[model samples]
Every structure is written in C-alpha cells, then in structure tokens.
Target: MIRFDTVSESTLMVHLADEIDVSMTPLIARLVGQIQADFPEQLIDLLPSYTSILIHFHPDKITERVLRERVQHCYQQWQNKPCSTQGKLIELPVFYHPDVGPDLTALAASQAMSVDEVIALHSGATYTVCAIGFAPGFAFLASVDEAIATPRHAEPRLRVAAGSVGIANQQTAVYPAQSPGGWQIIGNCPKPLFNPHQEPMTPFQVGDQVRFQPIDRQTFHSLGGEIWPHWK
Candidate 1:
C-alpha cells in the first residue's frame, strides 16, 4: 500500500506493496494516471522491486510540503478504485515441416527428444504475449513447456523467413518479418502478422493470448491464400 504525506515543494512519494507482473500493471497505470491528473507538475518514479512510488515535482507549482498532502489524496483514491485486466485471445495456424523447420532435428537432438515430441509440446500450450519487441510484430510468448526447453543455435542464421516460429529461453515467438535470429526454429505461420499497407499494421499486442495450430507442407502452400487481388 502507498502512503501519502506532505514532504517538500517539489517532491511527492508513492509506495507499492507487492511484486509487479502483467496482472498488477493495471494498478500501476491507474496510480500513474492519478498522480499525473492530480499533480500534473510531478514526475512519477515507480520502483517495482520494493513496490515503492516516488513523486518528483517542480518546486514552483506545488511545494515539497504540499506534495505529501497531494500524494495522500491520490493514494486513497487508488485504494478505493479497481484496476482493469480485460484482453483478447487470438489463434494462429502454424506450418511445421522439415523444409520450414530445418533445425528441428538439431533442436530435438539437443533436448534428446524426438521430432514429433517437440511439435506436440510446442503447440500444446496457451501462450501469453509477454511483450512485443525485437521486431515490428515479434512477440515474446510466455514460457513453453519444461519438456522442450532448449537454447538457440550457436551461430545465428543469416536470414530467417518471415512467419518462422522459434523458441528461446522457454518462450516461443513468430518472426513477423524476414529477420536474422538465433532462436531454435520449429515452425512457420502463413498468416500475415504485419502489413504496413493495411490498417492496424500489427496484429498482436502485449498481453494478448496466442495459440499456434500446426499444419503440414501441402496445406501450407495451398493456404498461402492470395492477397487481396486488386487487379486480377
């Protein structure tokens, strides 16, 4: 719990009571907004480890002494309010075959598992998008099953085709574009995850639920569904 009190003309204090994760982010957002709305002059400094909140403000607008009083007011508001955690779920189809997952054998060997075992484990779980980074549509799906935990190739591939699904550090990610990466390749999804020409170029966002459905080679080529035929 964050406590509020008068301190100085340019500083306010915010505090936290627990670990910061995807679930608690909403609460933090609410707090951040509250401080910004009430004390527009203050800068919010959040410490996730100790769950401490510090408010640094301009001495000219609200004095350091009144800052404490303002913080107290905001803290009470936060306590009485609720944080939201609503999100959407998405399922993408992935094609995992020898051609696409050339390194599957290598990866399977590294983990001492058969190729089929690797695919089953990879596609069996509901993954949460921990974060969207490293590339335009690249997402860090939360930890994969412990059974298939493996490392990326020692030598990062020069160019990995777009839609390539790779695993690293217990998480699986789809390469939205043709980019060089070291994550162990296991599959590919034909769906266009990113298209700058279309509206909302990005498909997935942070915290979205994503599940990969596996398909074979023949289906992969057949389902390469034609892009909107503007001329034909």
Candidate 2:
C-alpha cells in the first residue's frame, strides 16, 4: 500500500514501491477508472519502474482534502477487493539466424557462449512486458535470465532492424520496428510487434507475460513473417 499526500493544490502523485507485476496493474487500472469516472478534469500519469505509480491531478477538479479522502478510498478498495481482470497471453516466434541477429556473433563472443546457447538462454525464459515505451509496441521487458544480462552497446546502432530481439541491463525486448537502439541484438521475430492495423495494435499490453518460442527462418517465413529485405 502507498501512503499518498497532496504536495500541491494542482498535483497528486502515487509512490508505488513494489514490482509493477500483474497483481498491481489491474488494481491501479480499476482505481484510474474510478477516478476518471468521478473526476474527469484530472490527468493521471504513470511512471515506468518496478516500483512506484505517480499521479498528477488538477486543483480545480477536487480540493486537497477531498483528493486525499478519495485516494484513500480507492486504495482501500484495491486492497480489500478481489481483482477480476484477465490480460491476453501472446507468443512470438523468433528466427535466430546470421542475417536476423546481426550482433549474435559479437554477443556470443563477449559472453563466451555459442550463438545457439545465447538464443536458448533468451527464448527459454519467460519475460514480463514491463511497459510499452521507447517506441510503440517496443516493450520494456523484465526478468531476463541472469546469465545473459549483457550491457548496452557502447555506441548505439544507427539502424537496428525491425523485429530484432535485443537486451539491455537485466531486461530483453523485441524492437517493434527498424530504428536506432543500443540494446544488444541477438535474434529476430518476424511477427509485427506493433501493428496499428491490428485490433489492439500491440500484441502485448502493459503487465502481460511474453514467452518466445524458437523457429527457423523457413518456419518464420511460413508463419506469416513480414521481412522488409531492404530497410530504408
């Protein structure tokens, strides 16, 4: 539980001091729904981190006293009530080939592991979609295997391919589209990570769990992989 206090008449923030796991996401979502329904004038801001939910609100919507009372009520409701939200589970297939994982060789050499070993370490682990930022459907992932926690590139790449799977710090994620990034690329997933044309656009939402299953280039092509042979 967070102890929230109004710092100013126009601003309110939540200090979430725990992992932003599935358990807390729906609770916060419910609270936000309640607030939006009750007070449409206020704006809610969420910061990305394992811990902390920050909220900013308008002074005219409600007074500090009223806001405090309301926040407490919402917080209590989250604590006592049971959550009834179910998020979608998605599986993306990756083809770990020389052409796909451009940095595979260098990454494997740095870690003193073979390219196959690196791929196995990455896809074998179940990763949490921490947040969708840095880019659209470009997930901020968590819970990467301890063995493959490689550092970001010293010099960021000018053009990282779309669908490239990469890692940084203790997290690993797939780059939704071709763009410059520093995360170490180890493989590529043919599926569109972020497709605005699709129903929800992004395959994984915040707090959704993502698991990767390995596939060969042929399988990836057969599974409806979209590869822009020439990136421009």
Candidate 3:
C-alpha cells in the first residue's frame, strides 16, 4: 500500500513501505522515472530514500490537490507495468590494507577471521545500492556477508578521507569526500564518485549494483588514491 502525505505547501512525501526492502529499489526507480516524465513542469526535485520519496514542486504551477491526483495516476501506471529488479553494475577497485583502512585489522580480529578471509567475504558478493545520503554521492549498499559484518564505531572519526570504504551493521558505503564518519573502515576506493562539474554528479543511483574489487597498494596509488597522514 502507498500512502501520501503533504510535507508543506509545495512538498509531498510518498511512503512506499514501512520498512527497508531491497526489492523496492527497481520499483522506486520506475515510479520516479514515470513521475519525472509526466510532470516535467511542476516538479522542482524528487528525493528517494529507503522507504519513501520526497517531492518538491512549484506551488504556482500546480495545486496540492491537482498534483496529488497526477502523482497518483503515475503511481498506478507504474504498478500496472513490469518493473526490472536489475540496475547498472558498477565494479569499484579498493586497496584493503591497514595503511589505508585503519579498522581493517581490528574488525577482522573482532570477528575471529583472518584479514584475507574478511577481504574475500566483502569482495565476493555483489551488493545493491539501497540509498544515497550522509553526503553527496555516498551510496548505502546493503547486506555484507554476516561473518564479516561489523558495527559502527562508538564515536565517529574527526575526518575520513575521500574514497574511504566502510561497513556499518549490514550496510556498506564509500565516502565520496573527506568528512567526519563512524562506519568501520575496511578499504579505500580510488575512483572519484562525485564531481560537481559533471552532468550526473554521481555515478551511483539508488538501484545500482556495486561490486568491490580488491587491489594492491601500487594500483591504489596509481589510480590517484592518496594515503592520508594518520594512516601512513
């Protein structure tokens, strides 16, 4: 069941489900595409999260009543059509070393697993991009293997470098820029995930598939990844 709530005069929140479900990704993508195609004039922005979508629109162009009606029509149309669960596959290379990932050794020790075992488990499975938040272009990927899953640090770090790969509970993500964070650092990716000058800005979308490729220190630096001062 879909529920709609008015956030403000020109904003609407569409509640798709009560809990986070990986299956909702493709459905959310389909619904967003449909709405964007149908309401090009009135929509200012649309933000999709784990279980809801927040829509901002032009009040002058369309009233709340009319907009809700139009959105409902689009939702119904999406429901009637077939939705694909697959999204674009993205393979990200990471240097999983103690020099870059400070928490890598500790996490492996806590789990009673060897460093190589932890790395294998993390890079073995393909994960789905469930949501993008915490920072621009930071994608929240879901379901790391249970054996290697770890909790976030009790206190967040003062600054985590750009391209830092981390895991918290069952979710994993990469820090697109240097910022304060609490996720357990396990690796660092070399790719630049966010570029302000780029058209898309982010390579990841909510439904995209992500696979982490483990690499050596040489490849990491060769790809423009810098080891921060503390890690060195």
For model 3, residues 88-171, the per-residue Cα lDDT tens digits are 999999999988899999999999999999999999988988888889999999878889888998989999989999999989
Model 3, residue 55: displacement in angstroms? 0.4
* TM-score against truth, every candidate: 0.65, 0.74, 0.93
Tens-digit lDDT string for candidate 2 (1-232): 6766556666666654455454565565456556668777666543333444455666666576676678687787677678754446678899886677767788888889998898888888877665567887888777677777889988998888888888886888999888998888777888887888888788776556788899977898897665545422
Q: Rate residue 84 of model 2 by lDDT.
A: 57
lDDT of 3 at 169: 90
Top candidate, metric TM-score:
3
What's model 3's lDDT at 91? 97
Q: How many Å off is the CA of 148 in candidate 3?
A: 1.9
What are the runs in model 1 whose C-alpha is more than 4 Å off?
A: 1-85, 225-232
In what order do the candidates fall by lDDT, top score first? 3, 2, 1
Q: Return the candidate ranking by TM-score, descending.
A: 3, 2, 1
The number of the candidate with the highest lDDT is 3
Better of 1 and 2 by TM-score: 2
